[model samples]
Structures are given as structure tokens and as C-alpha cells.
Target chain A: MVMSWIWTGIVLLSILCAAATGKGGQLSSAAMQGAQAGVTLAVSMAGAICLWSGVGKLMAVCGITGALSRRMRPLLVRLFPSAAADVSLAGDLSANICANLLGLGNAATPMGIRAAKRMVRGDIATDELCRLVVLNTASIQLIPTNVAAVRSAFGCTAPFDILPAVWITSALSAGLGVMAAYLLGKVRRG
Target chain B: MTDYIVPILLFLAAAMALRRKENAYDVMLQGASEGLKLLVSILPALILLLTAVYMLRASGAMELLSQGLRPLFALLGIPPETAMLVLVRPLSGSAALAVGADLMAQYGVDSQVGRTAAVMLGSTETTFYTISVYFGAAGIRKTRYAIPAALFADLVGFCMASLTTRLFFPE
Candidate 1:
């Protein structure tokens, strides 16, 4: 709640400053348009994500996800050693991570939730949950559909300009995240 | 109407295909039933983040923030205009990309600034928006290091983008 209040204050401060400096009024029309545009974009994104989740679910029901999971299990197990063998929460987490990297957050979020729920059902330790959280946060994405979608939403012809940069940064961040998670796993009070 | 035809047709076809399959419907229902709480939790955070961004852009604070950071920009081979681009991109991704393209077209993509802008475009995440939304959705009460960590990652991204461009696209 404190953070929420602080955030609110910052918004008010930015608005007030913009208005006084005349930039606020200058861009009043554009800002209004932007708000409309932002809403449209957000809604579209939400819809797109929902669609993807549906497709993913279809894939799962058809045994596609399981098939893919089986193929990926070896590599996935290495990535998430603590996860139970075959048909485990860690495997689901890896699928979610994969989806997130592809910029399917909507789809990935569900998978992630499922994974977390499964982990909880398995009575996974808090430490593993935290590690999964870190991994999710640090999940290295390649396509960055959300970012690219945002770029396209704004009308850029070349959304992939940021691809290389995203790749490098995410890879490093994920590497660091995994290391940190591993270290924390070793030392956490839990 | 014609311009929208392709997307419309694609969706219709996909829907038709899905309708023929029973499994698709079940999977959709199962996943949709969850994550609603997380989505609800973060709505306020988004509203607040947007308000803050609006305020910063309004008060001329970002301009000041930009001006103060010019020297650092120059050191990284970043064009002055990119300050505005980076500042705006997170709030509105398309606007930032447009700015980057304009800079490239104006200065030639081979120019240091143009390339830097390109790299910048790819490298950084929408910091404030992302932090607000993700943290909000997850009900993450404490973001002890997420902000700093993300920004630090952005900084690293900025540096790497420039470095890689120079190495690969060397003049």
C-alpha cells in the first residue's frame, strides 16, 4: 500500500509538472489520443494472449505439449535439476519459460500458474518456489512478442531492431538469475 | 475493409479449425479459470504507473532528466535525441521505434547515433510499465531489487548494444 501511494504521488507530480511547463497542455490532445491508443493496444494484446493460450491448451489436450515435453525433458531436467522426474512441476515451468521467451506471456502465465500450483501440490519447498520465481523473472526471451507488438502498435516498420540487444541482455540476466537462485538455494533460511 | 480481410480470414479459419476439435475448448477453459486474481491485483499498479509517466512527460521533468544525462549519452556514443527516445519508448513502444527510424533516416543508419538508437531500441525493457504490471499481477509486495536490477540490466543492454554494433557494423 505504501508503494502504491508512492506511485500515485509520482504520477501526480509528473502531471502537475507537465501542466505547469505548458508541455502538458501542448500535448493534451496527443496524450488523450495516446490514452485511447494505449487502451486499444492493451485490449488487443490481452485478446491475442488469450487466443494463444487457447491454442496452447488445444495443443496440451491433443497430447502435443506432452509430446514436446517428452522430447525436451532431457534438456529441461538439466536446466531445472530439482524438479521431479518426468511429468513434474519443473518440466511445466520449463514449458512456461519457453513460452515466455517466445513472448507468449499470456499463454506462459497460465503455464506458469499451473506449474506453480503443481509445485505447491507436490509440497515443493519455498526455496524452490523462489528459485522458480527468479527464473521466471529472468526468463530469457528471443522473440519478445510483447515488445515487438508494442513497437508495431506504435507504427514502427522495423520492430526487430531491438532483437540483438534483447538477446544479449536477457541471456546475461537469466544467467545471473540462475546463479543467484542457485546460491540462494544453498543459503536461504528456508 | 480490404486491408483487414487477411487478418479476419486467418482468425475465422483458425476458429473453424479449433471448433472441429473438442480438446481445444477444454484446455482453454482450464487455463482461463486461473490467473484472474493476479490480473486483478495489478490493475491499480498499471493505472499508477501510467499516471506517473504522464506526469513526468508533462512537468518537463523528463526533459531535465534527459539534459542532465547528455554527457553520459555522449560517452556511450548515443545521440542526444535518443534520450527522448529511450524515455518515451517504454511508455509507448511504437513512438520510440518511430523516433529511432526517423533518426536513422535523418542521420543515416551507419552513423554512430543512428546505430546506437537501433541498439537501444532492441536492448532495453519497458522498465516502469513492466515493473508495475508484473509486480502488480504477482502481488509482489516488495520489489527490493527488481527496479534497480532491471535498470542495471538496461544499462548493460545499452552498453552491449553499442559495443556489438561497433564490432559488427564498424565504420
Candidate 2:
């Protein structure tokens, strides 16, 4: 992919620069530090996500997911007509998405995958699946918790300057994503 | 310094409270395990980034970039060193952090470069990192236009931060 090529080029260039500068030794030293920091960051984020996911699991067990599902059923039914009105997958998707907005991508991903699997495990038609894909792709996360957390870790004083821009970007991206998915579905149908 | 501590502690407390009847510690450990896996996956990239940063610092490529960008920085009323941070910040935040620290050490933290570096650090996202992780996770194989779009947003942030900081604290 083009992204792969760009990443490769950047890596090669950095390596070349490193070798040419005769600072290889120093680089290794700094690399250790960098790796350590990355570990800490990954742990913190993953921990937060897991904690939330655990709570979500509890809510589901307590029938909260079902209660919420009843309320969200109308909207979800409209979103995926191919899906059965009584399925738990719709509720799961909704709940997963709710967690994702709160900045829990790790938790959201598994929940989404489970929901998607449930929705499609039966003999659903291909067109409906495509629609579900579009909806999932267009799932707009209003507050980017991961981005905000990273900014805070980096010593950003306000940490919310890009809130306006990110929200706009997310909305536009979601809209385009949905449109693209719909077009892909339509093309296949045609 | 003290101000930052409160928010982090509050966050930790809230994360703990989310446990309710369940064991918060166990959940956090599960999260940590997942985080550790992510860390391991990206360890190679981090190593490369750190090395690249060290080489850049020692060989003075950062200085060269700063020199090249000095005029532009002047027009924007920012220090030349700030430009290097702008480019580096997105590529590798750790390296950028090291550079920022070095700059702060060289010049007082209250200096123009120091303040701009701080603002730049605060305002911008790690563009390459975010793009790589998000798009990669989503299985987005092509970023023909996305890279430019993200970087363009980063440019806007950098310019805005510099201008805003300068306007408020004209030095």
C-alpha cells in the first residue's frame, strides 16, 4: 500500500541519517528510553480501556444493555433493516460505541467485533451486511479520548484546543465513510 | 506541576470507582497486559525513533533545519528551533520531547523558543503515529490523501499555536 511505502521511506531516511551522523551509539541508548516510555503509555491506555470494558460487561449482565437496547431499538432498526428487531447484537453495537466515545477503543473493538459476528452469523443477505459495515465505519466518536490522553501526557496545558477541529473532522470523515460504503454496496448490487 | 497532578489523580480515582462491585485492580491488570502487548509490538518503532532522534541531535540536522526555517520562524515571530519541533513532533513525539527538553535547558524555559516549543507540544497531535495506528487498525491500506490532510491539520495547529502564544506573550 501507499502508506506502507511512505513509512518505509521515512524509516530508511531516518536510518541513513543516523548512520551518516556517526551517532549510532547514542541512538541505541535513546532507543531504550523510548521503548520504555512506549510501554508505560500502552499500559496506561490499555488498562483504562479494560477497566471500562469490565464495567460494560457488568452492565450487560445486569440487563442494563437490554434496557438501553429497548430504547435504542427504533433507531437501530432504522439503521439496519436486514437485522432482526430483537437481536442483542444491535444493543451490543450501541453499547460498544458508547464506550468508544468515552475513549475506550480497546474495549470498543472487541465489543464491536462480537456484535458484528452475531449479526452476520445467521443467513443474512450480503446487501444488509454491507449496510452494517457502512454504519460501523460511520460510527462517529464525538470525543477522542485517546488523542486527548496523548496530548495531556505530552504536557499540553489546555489539551482541548483541537476539540472543535477533531469533532468536525470526525463528522466529515464519518459522513464520507458512510457514503463510500453505501456506494460500494450499490456498486456490488449493480 | 501541582495543577497537573490533581487531574491525573482524579482520573485514577475515577477509573477505580468504575469497578463498583468488581475488582478494579484485576481489571486494570488485564488492561495493563493488553497495553504491554501493544508496547511490545511498537517497541521496534520506538527504538528506531529514539535512535533517529539522537543522530539528529548529534549531527546537527536539527540545527540545520532550524537554520533553514529561521526566516519563516521570524515572520511568524517564533524561534527557529521551534520549526524543527513542528516537523519532529508528528514523526516521533519522544524525540520531540527530548529536543524540547534540550531546548528548554539551553535557553530558559521562559524564552520564546521554549514557550513556542511548549505550545507546539500541547497543540498538535502526533500525526504520523495517529495516522499509522488508526488507519492501520482499521485496515486502511491506502492513505493517498489522508497523510496530506492530517499533516495539513498539523500545520494549522503549529501556526495557530505560535501566533496565539506570541500575541499573548510578545517577546
Interface Cα RMSD, each model: 5.8, 8.2
Name the regions of candidate 1 deviating beyond 4 angstroms. A1-9, A12-16, A19-38, A67-82, A85-88, A103-106, A113-139, A143-166, A177-190, B1-22, B29-42, B75-81, B88-102, B109-111
What are the models' TM-scores? 0.68, 0.53
lDDT (C-alpha) at residue B40 in model 1: 45
Name every residue pair that clashes in candidate 1. A11-B52, A14-B55, A14-B56, A15-B55, A17-B59, A18-B58, A18-B59, A154-B94, A162-B122
Over the stretch A14-33, how does candidate 2's per-residue lDDT look in tens digits? 45666777655665555465
Per-residue alpha-carbon lDDT of model 2 for B1-171, expressed as tens digits? 434542553354445445445555555455445544544444454444444444456544566667788888778655666777776877765667766666655664555666566556644545566544443333444333445444545555566656665665578
lDDT tens readout by residue for model 1, B33-123: 4344444444555544554555566567777778888888878765566777766755545556666777676666656667677666655
Give candidate 1's root-mean-square deviation (CA, Å): 6.1
Docking class of 1: acceptable
lDDT tens digits, residues A21-62, model 1?
A: 767664555445445555555555555555655655555555
- What TM-score applies to chain A of candidate 1? 0.64
- In Å, candidate 1's interface RMSD is 5.8
| lDDT against true structure, model 2 | 0.54
Error of 1 at B7 (Å): 11
Please give the lDDT score at residue A181 for candidate 1.
Answer: 53
